[model samples]
Each structure stands twice: as structure tokens, then as C-alpha cells.
Target chain A: MTVAAEKQPAVDRDVCIEVSNVTLRFGGVTSLADAGLSLRRGEVLAVIGPNGAGKTSLFNCLTGVYRPQEGNVLYRSRGGREVSLLDRKPHQICRLGVARTFQNIRLFAALTAFENVKIGAEIRQRTGPIGAMLGMPWVRRAERVSDEHAHDLLAFVGVQHRSNIIASALAYGEQRRLEIARALATDPEVLLLDEPAAGTNPAEKRDLESLINRINKELGVTVLLIEHDMRLVMSVAMNVVVLNFGRVIASGTPAEVQGDPAVVEAYLGTPADGGDGDAAPR
Target chain B: MTTLSAVARRARWWNHARVRRIGAYVFAGIVVALVTGPGGSEGHYSNGLRHGLLAPRVIPFIVGGLVVWAAVELGGRQLYRVRPLVTTVVSGSQRRWQSPVVRLVSYGLLLVVAIVYPMHISEFWRVVAANEIAIYVLLAIGLNVVIGFAGLLDLGYIAFFAIGAYATAYFTGRLPIHAPFTLNPFLVIPLAIGLALISGVILGFPTLRLRGDYLAIVTLGFGEIVYEFAKNQQGITTGSAGVFNIPHFSIHLLDINYDWGLPSLPYYYVSLGFIVVVMFLFSRLENSRVGRAWTAIREDEVAAAATGVATLKYKLMAFAIGASTSGLAGVLFASKVGSITPDAFTLQYSILVLVLVIFGGMGSIAGVALGAAVLTWLPELLRTHVNPQNRFIYFGMLIIIMMIFRPQGLLPSRRRAREIRFAEAGLEGADALGPTPGSGLTS
Candidate 1:
């Protein structure tokens, strides 16, 4: 059993994103305290926590949206450079092959879903304003590539039929899927999804679970997700980290952490505070 | 805390809401009366208060205010009732107008009218069209790039215009500090544009991150700084004595060597050519990936950044491009007018250009150009037939009515209309001008 557990992380693959000793604070509130997690290449890792447990904060830190006061986020680029993500801006971090979706949908509301996804796909394009203005053939080729990629991504996320719809006009579930499609457009080696299944119906949740599995298995992309849906998490996640009050309380295989006493105590509340039996993150 | 709480509790409503609303109209009347009334230059008071508070002038303002109130109160219900119908008809027509055949025909008609109308106008009106209207229209198109495409509020756009003018002057050896070698004003256009583009980047580096109001204030300051430099720097810009004898645009080609002399017709044709070229190029830019990045940045900066768009770089590019256009207009203006003063590039021109963009419909290139034409032409018409002194009062009223009725200008871009409608409808995005499926570059 010990040998199998030790060999679970394949020796050939490296960590895609490694967060270590990260601490984030907002004024007097310490949002994440000495919290850390590592996402191995081509695997699904879930960070499960109650409301305000700093799961989103951790995501922000990794994506360069929130610069932690201490600690480092190291990303291994496809070029094999172990680059530090701590000091870079969000766009620079994205270029280094890490993309993320927001907990609340942050799709470009005014743009069409196809345009929104194209925005991501076109990041790899080298066309300048002058080139675009002149309608150069090379620029056209770049645009066509991005357009084709946008089509494929929209299809992959099952929103190809609604690709022309304005992003804000999309149904909530479709918006969620569209957002995933947009993040994928950046062609990231690692995709960070913050509560992708938060408001989704059971059927949509099931769909998301399969999509996530496909993203990991077929596309060979690492995924780090923060979720509250135990069924979806257990079904898809290979590893789970439980956080409470900005601290990582337990981490292991989904089934192992499900039965851990510390994770249970954190979720159900402790004796010092009046215990809420099910402290769900909404 | 106790004092703050006490102050907060002192909620005062002196009259019923309706009475106060009417009274607000009355107050506007008094203010307009004081401003537009015959001044103390002709009156008894030394400081020129107008003494409108005591006379018939005050009565007119008060009457105007009451008229406004009547329109709001009486016309309010009718407006509310007709709004949906109006929106339906407007949107329906807007959709028809988007077809390729309709668009081509409309553009052709507009071009025909533009070319023919100038020939029939009086010489004075022709000069106004060539000089004032064309200049303002060019300035408006440049500003639309900043405020509409990039979503950056630039109140100091005229600063870039002034820079272009000064560059032309310097290049033509008209400034107090002469150029190393004189260049034809035609040849100086690119050089002046480059100068303005560079200045735009310099200004944007520190101020673009300020966002909205703060960004506006910073640009306003920059405009004032340039204006002051031109006005007071005797060694450089001749200290408001102005730069003169700046030669007009000419063609000194291999076979044709002709100076574009005093007649404004030549200037009009050349300026029209510039406008057409700019419109074509800008439309292409607006439909490109660069334009998409700008729209993305405007919609959600964080999302744009995380999606690998260099948001700041795209913003700077927009600012610089807009500035370059302003520079081009300045070069043309300087050469055609054969002179320029600091007074010509004041803060007033900046606000006027902004008004043109907003009145034209922010993002629509055709709309902005049309807006400039109409607004500038109306002033000339008023100067000829009506009292020009009170022209702004008419303008203020027109704007107020427009804002209350069709906030989307006389002509609006199809995409910009969607943006405004979505905002008003809480992001439902009931698309105006109908939907064009399979997006990306479709817009």
C-alpha cells in the first residue's frame, strides 16, 4: 500500500504549478496562511473548503491576480523552464501557460462567446496593430488559426451552437462552460477553475465532471479546482486538499480525506465554536 | 460618532418632490439668465454681474425653465408610452441598414451629397466647411479611437492636436526656433504625426492606469501644460504672437508644380481625401484583433489580462494611434490656415471634440463624422440666420432633449448599441441591429 502511494506521482512527469508557503492577507484578515499545494502534470487536484476558506485566494496567488506577501509560485513552462510566477503580472503569467476562470463568471459580457474565446486564442498571435490594419496575409492566417481554434474550443465545451450569442446572454450553465472554453483558448498547460460547478444543475455538474476528466486525460492538461460538490469532487479529483480558516487541514486521495477527522472537524465545526453540522460553501 | 450620527439623521425635504422638481426648473432659468444676460460691461456694476436678477432678461430665463418643466412633466408620460414603439422602429430600421447592399448605397449617397453640397454653398460657408468643420470632424474621429475603441477618457486630446500643429510649424521653419532645414507642409505630415504619437505614449505611461475621471483630469492637465507652453514660451512658439507665414499644402511633383493658394476649395478636397483614407483605415482597425483586445479590455480588465492580453500595451497603442490622427489633422490645419495661435488649441476645442464623439455615437466612425458635420454646420447656419451669441443655449437644450429621448446619438454603431442596451437591460443583451451569427471578426 505504501509503495503504491509513493509511486502514484509518476517519476517521468513534473509538477506543473507548485505553490509553497503562500501567505495572503487583506488588512487585518489573513486570507491564506502558510497554505500550499502542488498540481502534478496531467492530473486533477481539488481544493475543498468552506466559505471564505481562502481557496479563491490560493487561485489568485497562482494566477498573479493576487501577489502573496510571502512565498513563491513556480510554474514549469512547456519549454521546461522552472519560472517563478510571484512577481509577474496576470497577462505575463498567462503567457507562461497558466490560465484561470473566476468563481463568478467573468466572461467579456459585451463580446460574443466566439469573440471571447478568440481573445484567448489570439494571444499567441504576433500580429501588431499596423499589420491588422493593413490586413496582411500573415495576419489573416494568424486570425484564421485563432478562428479555427475558437471553433474547436466552443465545440469541445459544447457551446458551438451558441457561439454567436453574446456572452452575457448565455444561460448560466452555458456561461460556465463558455468560460472554460475561453480559458482553454489560452492553451494553458495548467488550468485553474474556481468553483466551476457552483450554481450548475446536477446534470450540468455531471457534464462538468466529464468535461474536466476529458480536459485532463485527452488534452494532457493539469487542472486545479476549488469545489464544494462532494460527489463531483470524489468522482473526478485524484487528490483533495481541505482548507479551513486559510489553513490546509488535510490532504490525500479523495476517499482518504473524506474520512479524515481534521477535515470533518473543520467542515462540521469544532467544540470551541458552536458546531454547525454542515458548514457548506455556497 | 455622535456628531456624525446627528448630521446623518437631519434629513431635510423642504417641499414635496414634485414642487422641488419644478423649483429645480426655475433655478435653471435664473442661472441661464445670469449667464446669457447683457453684462456689466454695459451695465452699472463694475465687475459685470449683468444685473439680470432685476429685469426682463431674468424673466426670459425663468420662462425657459418653466417651459422645460412643462416638457418634462407633460411630455414625460407620452415619452414613456412611445419609448418601446420608438425602440422597436429604430431597431428594425437599424437592422435593415446593416445589410451590405444598404450600407453601400447609403455610403454612396452620403459621398455624393458631400461632394455636391460644397459646390453650391456660398464662399464663406465653403471656407467654414473646409477649415472649421473638417478640422473638428477629423479631431472627433481621432478622439473616438481613445474614448470609444480603447475605453480611455482623454480630455486633453487637443494637446496632441496642438503638438501636431507645432511640429508642422517647426518643420516649416515658422516657429521662433527654426528647423535645420525647411520642409513642405505636405512632407511634414508624417513627421508631425510621429511626434504626437510619441507624446501620447509619454503621457499614457503614467496616467493610463488612473482610470476614468482621474485619467481625464491628468490629460486635461497635459493639454493645459502644452497650451501654456505655446502661449508663454516666447523663445519657442513666439509667445501667442503666433506662428504665421506657414505655407499651404502644395504639389511639387515631377510634372505638376502648383501651390495650393488662397481658395478654400483645394483645401476642402485635400482634407476630404484625408478623412476618407482615415475612415477606411480606422474601420479596418476597428474590425481587427487589436480592436477585439480593446473591447475585451473595456469589458473586463482582469479577465482580459488573465486571457493573455497585454491590456496596458493595447491601451497605450490606442492612445498613440488616436494621437497620431490628431497630429495629422493639426498638420493639415496649420498648413491650410497658414498660421496658428495658442488660442486656437484651447481646452474648449478638447471639450468640443468630446462633444462631437458623444453626439455622433461613440464607437461608430460614420456617426462621429456625421455628428461633426451637422454640429459644425448648424453653428454656421445659426450665425447667418439667428443670434449667434446665444448659440450655446440652443446647444445645451438640444443635448438635454437628446439625452432624455435617444441617448444613443443620431447614429450609433451596431455593437455599441448592444453595449448600451445590455447595460440598461441588466446584461440581457437584446441585440440591436439583429444578430450576426458566428462571431470573432463578424462584428
Candidate 2:
């Protein structure tokens, strides 16, 4: 399997994560079947599908939230290190520079906004439990850095005013932004955002489009998004991958996938019409 | 017409929710008094009721009603409306007491009082303070790390305590199976802690994955297993006879030599010292990075893991810390008593210690310590009034009432207070992480 994939010459070291022939099934139901995609370095790739095309499941497979029974997820870090994410726990994958946010907002609701971000930032720091307990000078220094970074990220996401407020008390848009800030705090080289603009207003959606661009361009991080907003995807994503019934039916530039007959038919009524993908945002 | 209107207005007062709650409290107080009250002269409630019309009973009821009403009303956020002067004085004193210099002076005075307290107390009281109150305080503080900090329920914690005591006995050559070399009780502290830590890791590695009630039931079974093993294993644990003649702790360093003998005062001092040390360490750990990690895990495990917090490792760490503390307390117990028995390490002690943690305030250091002291000593104080075996009946009543009235415990941590207060106000409750698999209303 490795020789065949290597012989193709497409699985290069620059691919941040490669999902090939990865299949996930729940009992008798198949959430994903032989689905595959590659996230290249420092690129914005959007995964689009109807309600049950297994977009989130593919994200889960990449982020180590779920294991694929059929194939493996290969993660290659920025410094030329290779790791198979199949056997790793969520935290271990996170430590390996893979960070993600949930489709449903999953911040620590009881913690302060600053605390939520700081918890994320501190995960990558090298401090053992004993060091934390002893409050060694280096640990304090590392903690101070994390605190400052949390403050910075909060401001970066434009929610610094809600620093001390508990996360549950924040507004809907603010919570979404705070979750982004938290995901960014992991210092991730690759970020997986699951439906970040799901319930936001038009103005908040505009803010989210720019935020994704900044996260991809300013931070030099590879972005893999599962978004339903076709306007945001066409405007921000470099390429789009469309899934239908747990299969990647279309993969190309935004304009190309937008005109694919399979994409239009899978989204609209039938394969006979040439309806633009922008009309199927729901 | 004016008199009739006034009568109607007066009748409407009981409809208020707060008033109805106070009425419920009064009824509960009355029921407790009636059921737990002393037997009548003829061993019948009617016999006692026929004469006085409950004169003293009526008086006690009125007093109790007034107290509950005051507690309910004053416990509200708007205390100034009732008495501005009282509220001002309370807030002013709290602010003053929390200032750095004032807190330092208060702590110094407190330490002095603690030191001077047992020295002058009666021998019987001193023994009770050390044997019953102080020991349980140590155990409660240990369990606080598990239940309070980690939000994991452990009903089999006493198993670790038993392990510690057995390690102490084995090290001192008191058990039927002797050690390779007899060691002083002081020397056995570290070994016992290591043993308890390893035991906790063994138990928690597989079972910690089970959340809330399931984890609690597993810990409960672990405790029963240890208890049965101690009871039935004659060759190893001396088979219900228990290990006897465990030596007292002593230190012989350089020219200075001190021995913990049969006097209970030294034991109280030592226990107090350990309690102080553990409190300091745990409090320091509360706001640190590790502490935040624990809070994150407790709040939402899946989110915590996604954010790179190792949930399993930190959870296992909490179990180990809690178990090691229980072990240390066990070593102290064996040394202080100079005898060990399976009777001392029962499921009842685990429940009683949990009660202390909840009664005091789950995560607050001073609160749990105060809870342990009060609950344990109160029963002893009532030794002449009530049979010792019936003490749990009162505790059950106290816990049930407390759960209804003040589920956050007596003095909650600031974060917990905020969460519970928000939850009570119908905010930050079911809607936040309501359907998440890692977080639920486990309690």
C-alpha cells in the first residue's frame, strides 16, 4: 500500500494531511466509504456536502476523534516529520500540531474567556505536572507567555472585551469567535474548522470570511473547513472538494466544482440541469 | 369592608414561593424533632402530647421557623433591603479581613490558637480531636482532590487508606507476613504513599473512563474487595484479628530525639501539620496550569482533549494524588493507634468522609476542613443526648436538607459559587453543553 501510494508521486512531503481510502462505519451504517482528500501546506481547502455527506466525519478521522477501520490518516508536520494519526488520541494529535473546533460550540462554558484560551495555549508548552505543582521559575515564565498569548488571541479575534466573562454568557457570534481564538492558541500548523459561520448574521459571516483569510495568510497555517456558505467558500477557499453520499464526487477550483453536473444534481433535483452551486447554500 | 380586605391580604402572604419554601423547612424541622426526639414517658408520642400541648415544643418550633426564614431571606443577593447597617457591617468586615496584612495577622492568630488549643483541653476531648476529627479531616482533604478538583466521584477511597495502614503494618513487622527488615513508622510513610499511588493508578486506569456513577460504583467495589481480602486472608492479614503492636513514629536525628508516644496531643499536632501542608499544596495547585487543565477536563473532556489537554493522564494524576493522601493519613492512623483493624477501614468511613467534603464546600480548603471537624465532633458532643449508632440518621437528614437548601455546600469556591448561582438563576444550565457526551448533570 505504501509503495503504490509513493509510486504515484502525488503524496509529497508538503501534504499536511493525506486521507486515502479512509472508511468509517458505525455498526451497519457507513458514515464514510473509501473517502479521500489531501490538505496541502499553507492552503485553504473547503469540504462541502449536503447535510449527511460525512464532512464532519472526515474531519474527525483527520483530527484523531475517530478511527478509520479501513485505512490510515497520514500527518506530515512542517519540520519534515511523518506520523500516522490512526492510533493517536485526540490530545496526542493536538500536540502534534493538529487543532480543530467542533461544529457545535464546545468551549469550557464555566471558564472565563481568557481562561478558555489560556487552557488551549498552555497545552503545547513543555511543563510536567510536577513542575506545575512546584511552580518552578521556568513554568511561571511559560505560563506568563501563555497568558499574554491568550490575551493577544482574544484581541486578534476581536473579543478582548469579553475576557473575564464566562464563556456561556457571551453572545452567539462572540462564542464562535472565541472558539476560533481558542483553536488558534494551540499554535497549530493545520486548523480544522467545522461550520464556523453556521448561525451567524450576515455581518458576522463577513467577519468570519476575513478571519479565515487572516488565519490562512497571516498565520501561514493550512486550513481545512467544512462550511455550507457557498459565497464564503468561493470567495476565500483556493479549491473546493464536494462530497455526495460519503463519496468525493467533485474536486477542483471553485469555478470548476461550481459547474460540475454531479455537484449540481447531488445538491439540486437531478443530474439533468446545470444549476450553479451558489443556489444550493442550504 | 376595610377589615375584610386586610384579612384577604394577610391570607395571600403564604402564596409567595419563598414563604412556601420556609413553610416546608419548618415542617421538615418538626418531623426531624418528632422522629428523633427522646421517647415519651410511656414510650408513646400521644402520651407525651396529652399534657403540655407542646409548650416547649411549640416554642422550639417557632424559634426554628424564624431561623429558617431568616436564613432563606438573608441568603438572597439583596441583603441590603432588609437591614442596610447589617449588610454594610458584614461586607466591610469581609473586605477588611481579606486585606493582605489583616489576613496574615488572622492566620498567625489562628495558628497560635491551634497550637494552644489541644495543650489545655481535657484529655478526653484532645483524644477525640485527634482520633476522630483530625484523622477524618485528613481523609476529607484527600477526597476533595478527586471529587472537587477533578469532578470524579469515588466511593471506594477508603481502600487506599486500608492499603496505607497495611503497608505500615507490614513495614513495622506487625502483620503475620513480616517484612525483610523492620522499619520505623516514619520510614514507612513514603513506601505507603507509593503503594497507595500505585493502587490508585491500577484502579483508575481502566475505571476512570467510566464517568460519574459508574466510576463511583467501581470504586465502591474496589473498597469491598480490599475489605473482604483483609477479613478472609488469615495468613497475610491475620484474618479479622487485625495487625497489632504497630510501633509509634519516632525520629532520632543527630543529638535531637523525639518520639510520638501514647499521648494524643502530639498526634493532634502532627495531624494538624500534615493538614496544613496538604492544604497549602492543593491550594497552590488550584490556579496553576495543571489546575486549569483539571478545570478544563472537568468542564468538558472532549473539548479539553481537542485543545490538547491530556484528559486521561490528568484524571489518573488526580486519583493518584487523592489516594496517596489517603495513604499518608492511614500511616498516621496506624502509628497513632499502634493497632490496625479491618473494622476501621469500612465503607462507612468513605461515605462519612464524602459527607465532610460536601458539607464544608467541595473545593474550598477551609470549608472541607471545617466540615470534617464540625460533623465529626458534633456527634461526639451529642454522645449523652443520642445513641452513637443513630448518628447517621441525623447526618442523612442534614445532607438531604442541605442538598435542597444549599447544594453548593457551606462555603463554595468562587468559581463553583458562580456556576451554581448562575445555574440557580436559570442561566448557564442545561443549554451549555447539555447534550455533550463528556459533560452532563452527573451529580
Looking at candidate 1 chain B, the ten consecutive residues that score lowest on lDDT are B434-443
DockQ of model 1 vs. true complex = 0.47
Please give the lDDT score at residue A209 for candidate 2: 94
Clashing pairs in 1: none
lDDT of 1 by residue, A1-282 (tens): 263368656732577777889999989999999998778887799999889999988988888778889888888877789989988888998888999998888888878999999999999788998988788999899989999999999999999999999888899999999999999999999999999998999999989999999999988888998898998899999988999999888887887788776787776666576554444422
lDDT of 2 by residue, B88-146 (tens): 89889888977989977877887798889888889999989888888899999899888
lDDT of 2 at A29: 86
In Å, residue B347's CA in model 2 sits off its true spot by 1.5
State the lDDT at B74 in candidate 1. 73
Give per-model TM-scores. Answer: 0.85, 0.89
Q: Which sections of candidate 2 miss by over 4 Å?
A: A1-13, A271-282, B1-80, B83-102, B387-389, B422-443
Tens-digit lDDT track for model 1 on B1-443?
A: 99887666554454446556888899988977766665443235532254668766678788889998988877899879989999999889879987989988988898788788899878998899889889889989999988878778888999999999999999989887978999999999999999999999999998877666777899999999999999999999997899999898888899999888888888988888889888888998998899999888776777888899998899999999999999999998998898999998899989989888888888889989998888888877767543566566667777777767777777887667778887687663222222211112100
On the 0 to 100 scale, the lDDT of residue A86 in model 2 is 88
